[model samples]
Every structure is written in C-alpha cells, then in structure tokens.
Target: MVTILFFGQLKERLDTSRLPLELVDGSKCLDSVAELRIFLQTKGDVWKENLAYGSALVAVNQQMATEDTPIKDSDEIAFFPPVTGG
Candidate 1:
C-alpha cells in the first residue's frame, strides 16, 4: 500500500487528509505520479475532479515532483492546489 496525502483545498474538497492505495495484483506499484493520479480518478467523481483536473501540484517525499516522477513502494505522495498567496 502507498500513502497519499491531500493538502490545502484538495484536502478540503476531498474531505479527508490521507488515504492508503492498494496496488493491483501482479504489480507492486504504478509507473509514475501522473499514472497514480489517473488511477485515483477511478474512485469517484470527486476524485476525478480533484486529481484529473491537470493543474494540481504534486510532491513525492516532500520534494516537488513532475507527472513522470517514478513511484515505488513506501513512497509518500502529496497533492496540493497551486499556491496563490501574495
């Protein structure tokens, strides 16, 4: 299982902070962070909206990550809306 945390507006929209994602059989993980987003979108309309919107920021292990960043076991993935404070 992989740990996924939601932050900022994402957390509020999702109405939860964290989730555990169980990889499907035959594979221990997904290909990359973007792929994970696609997978999460399958959950429901809320997930599809928040995760598939193509504008959220992603971090892996606290480091900013691109869509193609590789994902493996025990990784901590986080998603947050684009920062806009000024």
Candidate 2:
C-alpha cells in the first residue's frame, strides 16, 4: 500500500487531503513519480494541472524526491507546492 499526502494549495485545488493506493498488477500500481503523475491525470484536468511535472514538490518518506524517484508498496509519498518567500 502507498500513502499519498497533499498539502497547502495542492490540497485545496484537488479537494483532497490524502489518498491511499493499493499496489497490484494494474495501472494503479506505479513504479515512479512520473508514472504517478500520468496516472493522476486520469482523474481529470484538476489532477493533471496540480500534479504537473516540474510544478510540485515531492517527498518520499520525508526525504526529497524527484520525478524519477522509485516508490515501493509501503512508501509514504507527499506532494506540495514550491515555497516562495518575500
């Protein structure tokens, strides 16, 4: 099972705080963050825009992660917007 967490503006935009996916032999089971983004797109325009590549921050198990970062069944993944400071 994979635990997906959304934060900040991302949560508001997607109207979701958390999502859990059970890994199995199907499309829902993703290998990497890139694949996850593509999968999320299937949800519609809201997912596609919020999860766009190079647009959001990703973390795997509390550590920074990239688009190609591989995920495991028990991994805890989080996504959030890039921080901006004035």
Using lDDT as the measure, the top candidate is 2
Tally clashing residue pairs in candidate 2.
Answer: 0
Residue pairs in candidate 2 whose N, alpha carbon or C atoms collide under 3 angstroms:
none
In model 1, pairs of residues that clash are none
lDDT of 1 by residue, 54-82 (tens): 66889999999999998877889999998
Candidate 1 residue 56 C-alpha distance from true site, Å: 1.3
**How much does each candidate deviate from the true structure in C-alpha RMSD?**
1.8, 1.5
Instruction: Report the Cα lDDT for residue 85, model 1.
Output: 79
Runs with alpha carbons beyond 4 Å of true place in candidate 2: 25-28
